[model samples]
Target: MAFKFFDKLSQDFAELLNDKKEYNVVIEVDKEENMKSFTTHSVVLRYRLPYFDKELENATTNENHIKTIIKPNISAQIFEIILKYIYGGIVNIEDTDTKTIYELMVNADELELKELSVKLENYLIQSKASWLKTHFSFVYHSIFDSDKFKDLKKFYNDIIVKYPNLIFESEDFTSLQETALISILERDDLNVEEIKIWDYVIKWGIAQNPTLPADSKEWTKGNFKALKITLQQCLPLIRYFHIPGEVIWKKMKPYKKIFEEQLWDDMTQYFISPNEPITSLILPARIISNPELPSRVNEPFSTIIKNEHVAELSSWIDRKSTTYSLSNIPYEFKLILRGSRDGFHPKTFWNMCNGHVGTIVVAKVAGNDEIVGGYNPLSWDNSTSTSTRMCAKDSFIFSLKNGNIKNSILSRVKENDNALRYFDSNEQNVYGPLFGNCEFMMRSNVSDFTQDKQCQCKYMESPIFQIFYNYEKPIRKTIELFSIVDYEVFKVI
Candidate 1:
């Protein structure tokens, strides 16, 4: 019974829209010959669409109380569709192409029809998700042109992250607007390495000037000068510290003239002095590398990074998965605390380490400038006995700063029953199941620290397979990864 009433109401409104000639106003959508005019009643326009009502009030009128208005940018075809929605509240875009729909959406926003614009935006996202993907660059440029399309901007970027090739390798990549290109570089999940991204950043900078040669090989000092102007805002966004020392001295050395002297000095120190605390302004590792958040992340601990990087990490921790659709955890790290600042005594870390289990402890080798750390799956209470056994069974130590992991000792694990454990930690940073006293673990344990009897007195526990540590470079190139802990204490919510 209720359906009948709505049906009749719809029919009446449809008929009213069709009988537009009887109205006292005419809205001409375009000035071109054979242009279209919309017949609409001022009363309906005033009550439903404020833009039209205002247009009518300001509209030039004739003696017979009739008024005509012109809409300069909108085409008659789009107005025909918009008028129907205005009078009848029905939008039948059947068989409409994504381009026309995008045009219609743009017109809708200009007309100040907030609800209509939103409905069109949602339909474009859901119904034409794939089409949007294909036309991502065009769609993004359209959104970038106007700040009013905030939803479209986010929607476009969400898709960009899933298929980065759309931006990185697509023909449109070099031609993208400067802001759009910067947006791509800022994302952590870009699926490209920093070196590759740096190369691309150069390509984009070189593409800006048609007067300059397209090939960078032909570029002169003047070309670099021009590109420096274009990439001034983009230069700082790159994570220079993440790039290897050799690459910086070789590949980036060519571009060093553009960098500030202090910044260059900072990079020089960062690459040369491994143990020295970094004071330069460098961003911590990005928090979310995947679309979904991971189930677990290292609780905040000190490394080389400072407190400024925690806001993003904390936000990720608060929102990441507990058990739902899990995410792939990236091997990125952030600096949290340094014994140089926070004190080396184990009790100094008691408040940060006491309650948290699953804490990842990373320490820089004092003399060799190597990075060594372990993952603890159990809590670190002050009362723990030196004889504490490997009950958690998931704890393990690894070498990342340098050196080959001698055996299958430090394989990344999702979960395991036979994990390494540690005990006999003192007030200093020493605590691992691989040994009961102050000592190094694995093959290098016998190298120097062991030869010097670094541990009070005890043979370091042996792993199922030997692990190794080397400072200059890892025995296996793949092992050359280390993250400065950004925040020492964080938990996935």
Candidate 2:
């Protein structure tokens, strides 16, 4: 057998990537403020990627015989990774963040780098499965925009079929792509009721045409035609004969103008005489099953803290002298956001937790089991342009006892006017929940708290050397900055 020396060959080409002497292609990436250019050889790109092959054919060369390709959408970081892979036939994501890796996969697919895209897609599904679920909504909507990533589509579709509400009840359900909607409807195992599916389809169709009257009863024939045309692809996927006759009359009658005369007559006749044959085709009823709830739904409320911690936190919220027993906690801890599930970005915090009142923000310190958190009695506002301090007499900051820490500490607000600090909209991208004058705060310049160690629990003293504590005591024994393993924001209902 012949020997293989791909490692050496790869190393040689990788070194070539750094050589600026003979490059003939320049690629400009990212928007204006962050735009960056890279020099490359066209021969490497022409043979390595089909997308570049076509792009290079159409691209005109300058007098220096160097061709330029402008890609404002792709980030410079992602392109750098792609460029290395193109020349070296190697990819190293060991140090890259999961979000960056995901973006690289998307960009690779766009550039027709099927091998790279498929490899990254499989890696994400196998290694970063937790991250994929945490950013489920974004991932689901993004994959449907194109026909690539079949395995990812199947992976998410399996979850959607079991928990139909994840997609159907989402806030942006109406904005779902037509292909995605049809894929769900085409599923024989979709567990939702037929009537509800019909309603959602009608809702989706109506949302596409804003000019249509609010009331279907006030609709003109033209409006009906407009809606029918919008829903033409979706209409056929609905199981008409499967829905109850009463529901048909109640829901389907108003939109009768959309159906052909023969189909409508056939449906009506089928309902009147069950034994009669009809010209319209009848699709099989969906295979509905009351499957056991997925582990995600049945999992404990918070992955970072247990029920004992919840009881303790609840007792503190109501200012109870004694910790409430597990069975008799007064308030329910309703989780609105989880750093591991939603995202670790500070902006994700403002987007999801905005306007939420009576909230508790808990975070597990990295490299240890210690949990520190703050309570905010007022709503979190992301609309403000200037920094604003919320006033709450009952708000407090605390560190819960864990394996690494023996005793829990509670620090009620000593300064009522500075109980909580809400950052301006521009600063929200870097700063999350804040309490007092940097007494206990979550701040990340990199936009991801887990990726940075900027979050702190310090006790600051005034310039005059007098104690400038905003709260009664420090939550952590040592005043130091730390990263987090995970964080959760719950509404104390």
Candidate 3:
């Protein structure tokens, strides 16, 4: 038979026991199972052990711990209701407010039956059945007023220490809203990481918020401050999988400048390292060269004219001749003059110049273009294909700052005939094609920083070289090729 049948029978029996006019009966406290199993109509009275010590004593029997009989002239309906609650953790439709359930669990906890209390609390939270949300709010108010639940606090600590295993088996959400709600209620102390986890959940809806408001008499902004500090601390710990550092910044950007500033330091630790790949790093705008200043880059066939008097040439060559624009005014210029035409124009005049007296020229910038023409003043030492041409413009001199990579770079250029050179220019050579087109594509100016709220696109234009040498004047030049890092001149190869 159904347990409900025994429950009704128990209620009827209790009513009979309570009536003074009816015959009195003695009951065995341990005979409860007989009532439930015997007759479908038998009245079986069941009462869950209450918080009082007397209730436990009253419910217990000498022979068996689980079996018990109750002698009460209780109302049949009330007895039935209570009996249902004891067995099923719920009762059939009746007017019972959420406050009653909350109180019952509280009493259960007080009675040292923590398992039942915690289980019921968890069920309520999961069911979204907390009509007692207001009651929890009141509890928050009271807890906010004083530090109570000292024993429960100790239990909470132990529970957290074993959280991984305990939580895995439990039905609670990873980030429980009640946790924050409870902390707000009980003046509970939570560390930085815990608070952060709570804040993330609450903001993201994985957890619920506490009932207290910022302006309530019981409310204080201390929790908000704690939440902020928690988020700030978590920013660095989140980089284990190499997420883009900028994403973290975007999430935390609304904070005051001081907070935003600190986040940079935290993110920098993960974004920069000698061994780290360039693609993984996110550097501030300051480290890059200004796209507006094209001179920062070095390229093959580019020339730097330290002497301001040397005529600088424009990037384009006249279609009719082998000579590049001007060959005398000193300034950086592209050594390989490339355009639609690429054959020997016998009509073009070549003014041979000696190296030591003509001007110091460098070649092999990291780009593609022809290395010889009428503008290539340095004469070849051997047959056309066998000789290395001296670049009037594309190149860079050796320096410690730009990786001192000139010599090795020059050697590679001579051997490959197709390598672009890169180096830093500190202004000694004015005739060099100041920088390359590719290098100009990756940077911006510092003045634009405040104007940009987010990282912006680099819409820099391509490089246009203007010759700084005077081509009209006849000159003698000796052709010599130097490596990008090893500044040695290349012999005929």
Candidate 4:
């Protein structure tokens, strides 16, 4: 009932605003050499519009006690819309073009109709995002030209940050004001190389001079001086030390006169002797460009393991460490198999673990609930011809305890040492004769450099060391020795 009453009252007020009458105040609108005038109720003008209220409050009374307000800049079309909104409590901007709406935004801003101005800005952003990107030059010039449209300024600034290359490489980059260019240069995470940034700066500076030669070979000292003058404010913003030494000595040598004597000498001396302190006390923060999160789009590997050991093993391979996330990892892990779920025999497991490169193995110890995994970058083969497929230096094993990751075992790929190589296992030729330079060994009575036999999965080839349930070191036996908690297999693509 209360809502209905307010609704009726609103309609009546709107009807009252629409009613035309002989009003007391005259608002003259001049546009395109045409003079137009609107008569408005003085009461409504003072009550509805703050701009008019301030104008009338400070205005001196005429002989006939009439107020005449002149707006020479506003067009008749825009004023008509504003007048309707001022009188009828409705802003009907439908079917209006972007330019007219832009004009209305300006007019609304001038009239202090903040709500209507916000509405127009939102409409432009939603409806004309593409057009705005295309005509960034016109849009940037118009918005920054006036201090009224703050929302518009922010909208453009955000889009510029997301796709900075669009503006940085555009022809209008040279026309960008110093403040605008500084805005782009200030962000440390602006995804661009230092060399590309230097090139753009030089281009923008060169564009500032009309008399400058197009070919850099024909550049004169006067042209360089002119460019330096144009880029004097911009040069300080660039991290000159971060650029390559070759580029500094070769590309920037021509512009040496531009830099202050002290700064140039400091830069040159710093390159010569990096250990010595430089003039600038600060260094640029390096860009944090870690890989983005992986997409589960192309048939992801997900498991609901019943045992805690298998659960944690599955968690680590999919880049879900309790302490670390996989956002920094560049590979997408796809489910290849699970040892307990697949019910693979020892011979089947060996055959399956042979030739698949980039495989990760997560084994959970039943006694201590310690999770261990190995990353194999090279595939394993059964050939005893001293082949390159024997044991890889890139293969590494890791341990996860209490959700923290630690590197447990790594292959000793050292020069003048053939210790961590695969040869015929004294026990069996199919899966034995595993000798490696593995760290944190249980026991290696085989030799000083060569360790005990390591297990190899024949199909998915990687050196594997067995983990005992109640003990760290297992006796020289196959998978038939102890009770296993669980194990998971993953392929990193």
Against the true structure, whose lDDT is highest? 2
Those runs of model 1 whose alpha carbons end farther than 4 Å from true positions after fitting are 1-12, 15-21, 31-35, 141-154, 160-165, 174-176, 180-191, 249-269, 275-280, 287-493
* lDDT tens per residue, model 1, 238-276: 888888999888888877766778889999998889678
Worst 10 residues of 4 by lDDT: 467-476
Segments in model 4 whose C-alpha atoms lie over 4 Å from true places: 2-21, 30-35, 58-65, 135-157, 211-213, 216-220, 249-251, 265-273, 280-282, 285-493
Sorted on TM-score, best first, the list reads 2, 1, 4, 3
lDDT of every model, 2 decimals: 0.56, 0.83, 0.29, 0.56
425-467 in candidate 3: lDDT tens per residue?
A: 2211111211122111111122121121211111223223212
lDDT string, candidate 2, 211-306, tens digits: 999988899999999999999998888888888888899889989999989888988988889789998889999998987652223458789878
Off by over 4 Å in 2: 1-22, 28-36, 42-77, 84-103, 110-115, 123-148, 261-279, 299-493
lDDT of 4 by residue, 348-424 (tens): 33355556555665555444444544555455344444423243444444454433323232222322132233433
lDDT of 1: 0.56
Q: Which candidate is the best by TM-score?
A: 2
RMSD, one per candidate, in order:
21.0, 14.3, 34.5, 23.4
Query: In angstroms, how far off is 424's CA in candidate 1?
Result: 76
Question: What TM-scores do the predictions have?
Answer: 0.51, 0.53, 0.24, 0.50
Tell me how far the alpha carbon of residue 482 in candidate 3 is from the true structure, in angstroms, after superposition.
93
TM-score-superior candidate, 1 or 3 = 1
Q: Which ten contiguous residues of candidate 1 have the minimum total lDDT?
A: 468-477
